[model samples]
Target: MDPDRVPRVRDMRVRVLRATTSSRARGPLLCIGTVALIIAVILGAWVRPAPGTTDTPAAKSHALSVAWPSQGQASALVEGLGDSGDLGNKGPQEPVPIASITKVMTAYVILRDHPLRAGQRGPGITIDRTAADESFSGVESSVPVREGQRLSERQVLELMLIPSGNNIARMLARWDAGSQEAFVRKMNRAARDLGMRHTVYTGASGLEETTVSTSSDQLKLARRVMRDATFRSIVAKPSTTVPGVPGTIRNTNTLLGTAGVIGLKTGSSTPAGGALMWAATAPDGNGNDRLILGVVLHQHADTNPRQGSQAALSNSRALIEAVREWLSTITSGTG
Candidate 1:
């Protein structure tokens, strides 16, 4: 297949189905998404850091310039468990509805306040009637939970991040702080601390139109997420057994095991469209390893359920593949 002719997400929305451990678009922007994606990847290898991350030597000594989608945004940021700056970014920096990608910040706040060791289920919170009743509300995705169920923090995190349980996000928020309002306040403070000036949090879940951000801001959050061992392990899972879910609650991110995509989050809605924040490790031209974090926001998709997530993922895959190609050039001595 031609690198510049990657396919679009036309018929992949089944992957985002709301599940009891169960179910699951081809578009015209194929060429642009492919070509522009490669530019971000190659530039990702050499572009300077933005603010919080360390800088790296530019690989080819050219400025990053790519024509991205007019209706959406995309970026390939420097990836490291260590703090990184920036690599290459395309599209508008304006804050847009990010949907459930808001959960990334939710998870980050939890991890920051209550650090967890790998494999150790942190504090357990008993699921009350209110939590259970709220779990299956409205149109947002959710997992099974009983009113009286007791679950560990890891399990809640898994359900919230994997299946995008909006109720679970609130549960975590309430547990972390005393009330949802207080937790959201914490979220905004964390955003400011991280230099996410354009980012704001109206709720722990991205279901609110008020919960918004840009691709660039999300890339910053993703960089922080990749460094956390617990978050990394959970996001990489295609599926895991949750305490309340009878069937395994699988990951919504279909790209998990492919193309070095380890772990991340996916979100979609009528207003927020589809969005994704992803990370992977690939070698640059120097045969040295580089972590590449990519984000695609406001991607075009069908109105059906997670159709936006489907579209976001399809584009995300193209971007990751482009980054992989960029890395292969280094190992192949062509870089």
Candidate 2:
């Protein structure tokens, strides 16, 4: 062969060998990379956190925190009183309107601000024309306060709460603070002081749409109210007749008849629907006292205040029973 041709042949062979080696090396690398990518995808799908989960430490801590009991869980604050199913099969924080239950707060605030002597009359309040016109006239469930009548602060409060009188709420709000707006502000401030963050007061009668509260907040308020001996007595009073009212007014709380039933409030409005706050005290197996504050809000069936209160009373009774049973079982080692 010629020298030039031989050199060219050698160069071509070298190039071919290099290309073969490169192909051989590239094949394994490509295969390995593909395998690695597939493994990564499979692992990612299998091991990843489910949706709505937070991977951060703080979120993880929150996830591990305790949660409220679900609806129908059998647990009682007091043992040996009744079973879990007795009061009502309901969650602790179900939102209900709590109708006249709002009065419990009004009474509490008044009592806190002014300490009245036992049998001492409340501050005298002249009935406003508006209050008188709207006062429980022809209302089956009101303590009648005449248009021109002058009523003691305590008397008006009793009428407001005991009979769930709308007029009394209005009158008291206007009487104590000079205006309903001022009284509402005081009520909201009091609620905030008690750590009822979810509560807002726009009306003394719970008639306004702006006046709102959650079940949890109301329960907290009820707990505080029940702690007061005087407040408890006032709420538990079955019947009280005012001197000026035409007919005797009875307490609207139906739980008064239930065993171990203490005192609480009930409320209802066109906007709020139906709501209730209640506390029950029952003896445990060892005769220890157990107290529970329950609240319910927004039942579909209770359109009227009267019907709503009835439903709440029935539901509360069932819940109390369920809680009692749960507690009894816990003490008996059968829970």
Best model per lDDT: 1
Those runs of model 1 whose alpha carbons end farther than 4 Å from true positions after fitting are 1-70, 80-85, 301-305, 331-335
Candidate 2 C-alpha lDDT tens digits along 1-335: 33434554555556555555655667977656655565555455455644322221221222222122232111122323344312322243323344566777778777777656666776777777877677646732345566778877677777777778777786777767888889989999999998988677777776555566666576667767666666776777777877778776777777775856776667665545555666777654554567765665654333675565565566667666554443433333321
Global lDDT scores for all candidate models = 0.74, 0.61
- How displaced is residue 200 in candidate 2, in Å? 1.3
Best by TM-score: 1
User: Cα RMSD for candidate 1?
Assistant: 17.2
What would the per-residue lDDT of candidate 1 be over residues 5-36, giving only the tens digit for each residue? 22222112222221212311334365445545
Question: Ten residues in a row with the worst lDDT in model 2?
Answer: 59-68
